[model samples]
Target: MLRTQIIKLTRAPIRSFSAAAVRTAEGDTGGVRSGGVASSDSFNKREAASENKFIREREMETLRQLKEKLRAQRKHLDELDAHISDLESTKGGEQN
Candidate 1:
């Protein structure tokens, strides 16, 4: 999922580089020129992938914690509602 997002974000940059390379005569003329682009792009992609993974993991952890908190809150609300209903019924009995 994160890979898909990163690729989508970097697609334009990658395409622009490809287009420029095709337009330049010296772009692929030498071994060093070709290898340099490949190496740099590979390093950049690896770094981006790692960063995305970390972000995703952190988001998942936060979501899990939030869910647990919401569950506990719901339970507490239910208990309060039950207690209020019981008190109201007792008061009605006394009035009768």
Candidate 2:
């Protein structure tokens, strides 16, 4: 799962790079171009946007997993507390 996400995450940059390269080759700058290559500014902007989206998605996934773990732990802690209370009550009864 994580490996797949990482693969996808890493692929975005390459995909964007190749797309930009093709666009540059075709002279589709949509604006000014220098040295026969698309402006780095636009490319960088797109890359940064994609990266930010990926990071936000990844962080949300991590937070979801953490929340699930915390819920399970809380449930287990509640069960343990009940068991301890039962044991204490039984001990008190036996002494009476």
Candidate 3:
């Protein structure tokens, strides 16, 4: 199917969290009545920290991939240059 081909072509991963779960957590904290603000603030801080960690990990992975690609491209370029030099040398010899 067309969808299958699209999935194969895409390499990026998708992540999602449900809003209902978040609302439920807030609702539970609200039901506690006492220390609700403190609890909410703590929960929010934890959530933010988790998101930040995930972002950093994804960034590191992307950077790692880019570094690997750069190394491969550099190696290919070096090989091409060497081939060109070889051809030039052969041509010079032919001229003489």
Candidate 4:
């Protein structure tokens, strides 16, 4: 088999260092050098913040549920106390 192939190469546009720096400072680096590299710290911070928010929301929900459970238990204890007091009063009258 005898075949010839033609390939074309394209050059990326060039930008001055000062211009690139300005873009980087403004946080608009388009994700690499030819465009702009995204800052790793900023990306990581964003991810951490999102994870923290999820954790906080879950914890808050759990706390709310626990508080509700505590309130119900307190109410039940108060009712039990009232019933015991009534029973004690009746027994005292019967004894007298």
Candidate 5:
């Protein structure tokens, strides 16, 4: 009964593997036993959480770098526009 409950709590892939690997012994209530599968499950949860944190940090760093590059490109374009305006004014004055 305890094993059945645990199997239900686990995700499908882990459930399948754990159901096959878990060994049970009869308890006084016929529903309880002692083991460390729960500990193993906790470890897996922690590892997955750590991996997700790492992925999120990497994604945020990439986004920040892209934003900096975009800002630099905009600055360069603005400079070019100012230069073009100056050249156009000089040419108009010369033609007069």
Candidate 6:
């Protein structure tokens, strides 16, 4: 019962190669291979495209984060430079 539920939840709605195997086992195809070779090819292409899209989105997010970090660091460096210059000018005035 639990196994059946898992199968129902995990399986795609479309009939797949496993269904074809089951049909063959039940003599639906009389132990002969059907002409759905193109279906598997299309399925593989779709899966690959999905994985590629996922990777691309992750890479774009990582790039956006890095850009934000770089912008922050640049701002901090500029602030530090301004503070150092202010300190130097004050010390020069005191010595004069």
Q: What is the per-residue lDDT of model 5 for residues 1-96, given as tens digits with 9 covering 90 to 100?
A: 999899888846533635466566663223323566686567668988999999999999999999999999999999999999999999999999
The better-scoring model by TM-score among 1 and 3 is 3
Cα lDDT computed for each candidate against the true fold: 0.84, 0.83, 0.86, 0.78, 0.82, 0.83
Q: Each prediction's Cα RMSD? A: 16.2, 16.4, 16.4, 12.6, 14.9, 11.9
Runs of candidate 3 exceeding 4 Å displacement:
1-34
Model 1 alpha-carbon miss at residue 95, Å: 1.0
Which tens-of-lDDT digit does each residue in 38-57 have in candidate 4?
66666768988999999999
Tens-place lDDT per residue, model 3, 1-96, is 999999888968666766454356443534553567788688778998999999999999999999999999999999999999999999999999
TM-score-best of 1 and 5: 1
TM-score of each prediction: 0.62, 0.58, 0.63, 0.60, 0.58, 0.60
RMSD from true fold, candidate 6: 11.9
Per-residue CA lDDT of model 1 for 6-96, tens digit only, reads: 9898876534535354354664443353557788678668988999999999999999999999999999999999999999999999999
**What is candidate 3's CA lDDT for residue 12?**
81
CA deviation > 4 Å runs, candidate 1 = 1-35
Span of ten consecutive residues with least summed lDDT in model 3:
25-34
lDDT of candidate 6 over 46-92, digit per residue (tens): 98899999999999999999999999999999999999999999999
- Backbone clash pairs in model 4 (N, Cα, C under 3 Å; residues 3+ apart or in different chains), count: 3
Which numbered prediction scores highest in lDDT against the true structure? 3
Note the clash tally of each candidate.
0, 0, 0, 3, 0, 0
The C-alpha stretches of model 2 lying farther than 4 A from their native spots are 1-38
**Tens digits of per-residue lDDT for model 2, 1-31:** 9999998888745344353543355635465
